[model samples]
Target: MITFAPGPSKVFDQVGQYLQDAFQTGILSANHRSAAFMNLYQETETLFKEKLHVPEDYKLLFTSSATENWEIIAQSIVESSSFHIYSGSFGKKWYTFAQHLNEATGSHKLGTEDALDVAGLEIDGKHDLIAITQNETSNATEVSQELLGALGEKYPDKMIAVDTTSSMGGIALDFSLADIWFASVQKCFGLPAGLGVLILSPKAIAKCESKGESGRYNSLSFMLENAKIYQTHYTPNVLGVYLLKRSMEDHPEIQVTDALVRKRMKELETVIAQSKKLTMLVQNSETRSKTVMGIAGEELFIKEFKKAAEQAGMQMGSGYGPLKPTSFRIANFPAITEQEFENLLKFLKEY
Candidate 1:
């Protein structure tokens, strides 16, 4: 069945072939430190640059998931405290998780529909790292580029980390704006759930060295040392990297894909606007996420609608967190073809 679930959401149409190629090429059995694996890892990093427009100065590394990176950031990067700016569930979850590791973690909350006013929000001097979720998957909201820019401009000396879990590959990211950027491949890369990409600017790398904490298995310093030789700090997700490389090899560059995703987002807005039964969970049009769209309706209607969509051979994303009962999400990743979106829209139009 066609899937529009936000994550573990849609596999690329070529994934079956990719899996076969992996087996045929012995990618599953290759040693993480072997010459072959090193070659594979290096090639994947190269593809990330060519396809995603990641900056050359930024260092690339892999992790089990985005959640793991949170711990990595806490252990290796934050010495004093990390201040968080967020609105929805996932962002709050990150801030909460940071608190367990660092006692002085700070948070600034905003309303779900509120626009980001960066100049007005005061950040404490003690918080060394500033963290924000680039996309709020739970509510289908995104942090504005202008706000990110404002933060970078105002705090040029501070470290900035962004969780771009849902929007990384689907949009054109401004890598220069943040010191640390991370995302799981499931949402936008059309890969499975096991792999997450972490990128660190030279400034971020300097923080890891200055903090000088390398005890954790996922420490930034350890990950960096191995990455220099095109290796991972631990037993790697060999198959996942193989699949990601193949996916990136065939994918269009970010600018082309970004245009398409944004165009389709507008189409979805039009469809939702015409629908008597649906309203967007994110009311601010500018803040609506380009990769994931959350649409709301009556509780029973949402249940029936999802059931009907499933019967029509489409698997819709369930509502997340507090919005679960009244809303459902749609994944607008690159794997979802225009024709597939049209098919889903046809059903949305009819229902």
Candidate 2:
């Protein structure tokens, strides 16, 4: 069935052909240390940097999942305290994970009604790292670029780490806003759920070196050293990396993809706004996520809506966390074609 789930939601129509190419070229069997594998790795990094507009100085590394980056940041980057700003479950989980490593960990929970106003929020001077979720997958809320820029200016000394799990590939992000940015491939990258992309600014690298903590195999220093030569600290998901490279090559310009997503978002939002039975979970229009749209309605209506959509040959995402019974989510990733989205919108309008 066609899927509108938030993650692992859809794969590009050409992904199967790319997989076949990988297998024919024996890339799937190549050793991580082999020249062929290193070339593939370097090509993937180069494409990601060029397409995503990542800075030349920033380093790109891969991990098992975005969750792994949370552990790495706590273990290798934060020395005294880490402050998390969150409005959803994943962000809360990241803060709780940091608390286990640093006793001085703190958090700021943004109210659902308040626009993300980090410039007005007071952060403790002792907090060395400021963590922000660029997109909250659970509630379909987003942190505005203006707020991120304001935080970067206000706290230049503090490391800014952003979680862009659901928004990364489909949207264009200003790389200068955060010292460290990470996302899993299962979402917007239109790949399977085995790899995470971590981009680190030079400031982040210095923080890791200055901290002088190095033991884990995935530590920043170790990963950086291996990444310099286009390699990983351990064996990685070669197939997933190959798929990501192919996806990037297909849509080489991020701005073009971002525009497509924006157009589709406008279409979907218009339909959602006009729906008599459905309402947005994110009340503020400015904060609603472009990549993942969350809709709320009566329990019976939601159940019937999902059931009818499924019967019409579509699989939609159930609402995350506490909103599960009253809401549902739809992914607006690049992998979803305009025709497919139009079909879904038509179904919603008719339902």
Candidate 3:
């Protein structure tokens, strides 16, 4: 079946060949400390910097998942307090996780209707770190890049950490706007859910150095020290890193993928606008997420729609969190072909 599940969704068509090649070449069992593994790590890091436009000065590290980055940040980066700003369930969960680690952690929940407004946001002076969810996967709302730029300017002293899990490879982000940017490979990277990619600015590294809290085995300092020599603090998913490198090589240039995603998102928007039975869950078009589209309708209609799509050989994502019964989600990732998207749109029209 053609899967539309948000994460662990669709992998690149070349994944089978890459995996086969890895098995035949013994890449799956290569020692993490071997020269071969170091080369592989450097190659992947180069691809991220050149193709994905990660800043040259920033350091890239890998983790088990993006969730782990939260703990790393709370323990190593936030010295005094952190202010979490969220618009959806995932963002709220991250905030709660930070609060558990630091008692001084606080949060600001933006109103759902005008969630993208960050111009008038007031952050406490005591909070040294500002956490922003770049893309709210649970609700399909995105914080604008322009808004992030504004925040960086307004609070230059406060370190900014952005969670770009669902939007990372699908969009071109301005790396200078935030101090720390992280994402999991499962969504836009077109890979399985095993590895997380983190890009940290020099400011973030300095914060970790000054704080010097070695909270976990995968602490920022340990990861940074190992990453300097193109290695990890512990054994990592070698297969996941290989797949990510292959996927990046397949694209070569991020603009090609970004343009395609924007084009397809527009097409999908047009189709959704023309449909009588479907409406967008995000009322404001400006704040709507291009990577994940959430559609809302009558409860029975949504149920029947998912059933129809499934019967037609499409496995779409169920709405996340509380919107499950009245809405459904569509992943607009690179692995999905133009023909597949057109076929899904045609099916939606017929339904």
lDDT string, candidate 2, 1-351, tens digits:
899999877988899999899989999999999998899898988897899998888888999999999999998898888999998999999999998878789999976556777657888999999998889999999988888999999988899999999999989999988999999999999888999999999999999989977878788888888888999988999998989988888885889889998888888888889999998888787888889999999999999999989999999899998899999999999888778888998998888
Candidate 3 on 1-351: residue-level lDDT in tens? 899888878988888999998899888999999888899999998999999899889888999999999988998899889999888998999999999988899998875556545667788899999999989888888888998998899999999999999999999899999999999998999988899998999999989999888747878888898888998999999999999988888885778888998998888888889989899888787788889998899999999988988899999899987899999999999989888989988887777
Cα lDDT of model 3 overall? 0.89
RMSD of model 2 against the true structure: 1.0
In model 2, which regions exceed 4 Å deviation?
Answer: none
Name the runs in model 3 displaced over 4 angstroms.
none
Off by over 4 Å in 1: none
Alpha-carbon local distance difference test for all models = 0.91, 0.90, 0.89
TM-scores for all predictions: 0.98, 0.98, 0.98
Candidate 2 colliding pairs: none
Residues 1-351, model 1: lDDT tens digits: 899999988988899999999999887999998999999888988888888888988888989998888999989999899999888998999999999888799999878778778779888899999999989988899988878999999988789999999999999998989999999999999988999989999999999999899777787888899899998989999998999899988988999999999999999989999999999888887778889999999999999999999999999899987789899999999999878999999999999
Lowest summed-lDDT stretch of 10 residues in model 1?
Answer: 110-119
